[model samples]
Target: MPPCNSTSHAVGGNTWELAVVWGVLYSDSAVVWGVLYSDSAVVWGVLYSDSAVVWGVLYSDSAVVWGVLYSDSAVVWGVLYSDSAI
Candidate 1:
């Protein structure tokens, strides 16, 4: 077994929040697994859509950082998008 190194980061918004963690590898196991890590991104919030209006369009641009795995480890994957309507 190898020693584990850990790291973490976090971010938040009016409608969402995200967090991530990573573990580094060491010792003999290093050659087998390379690096060790884990992370997660969560989004939770409330918003209101205008139901009383007709033909209303809401636009938004959004992005989030999430967890990825490589050799039994976790990494960060970020995504971006635009022209979102409610």
Candidate 2:
């Protein structure tokens, strides 16, 4: 794993989970996988479900998602789209 500029690691599920600042977190895992960004300052988590072999749930501070997303399946159901971010 490449060294992150600034981050805080929160271990869970046998993975090296990290909270990064102004950086990207990605992976090349298979099945039952996803990517997310949690702005620790705001206590918000954006869970993006996809298997594009590419980036997913793209956001630029907009409500309309602009990308080729396959599907969003949340194992932990009812992920709230907080109005503060949209």
Q: Pick the candidate with the highest lDDT.
A: 2
- Estimate TM-scores for all models: 0.21, 0.24
Error of 1 at 1 (Å): 16
Residue pairs in candidate 2 whose N, alpha carbon or C atoms collide under 3 angstroms: none
Clashing pairs in 1: 23-36, 23-37
Task: Please write out the lDDT profile of model 1 over residues 1-86, one tens digit for every residue.
Answer: 43434444343634433343334433343222223233343332222222321111222224433232222123332333333341
What lDDT does candidate 1 reach at residue 18? 31
Per-residue alpha-carbon lDDT of model 2 for 5-84, expressed as tens digits? 55555557454535554433454464334344434332222344246323234443333333333333433222223334
Relative to the true structure, candidate 1 reaches a TM of 0.21
User: For each candidate, C-alpha RMSD in Å?
Assistant: 18.3, 12.3
Q: Which predicted model would earn the best TM-score?
A: 2
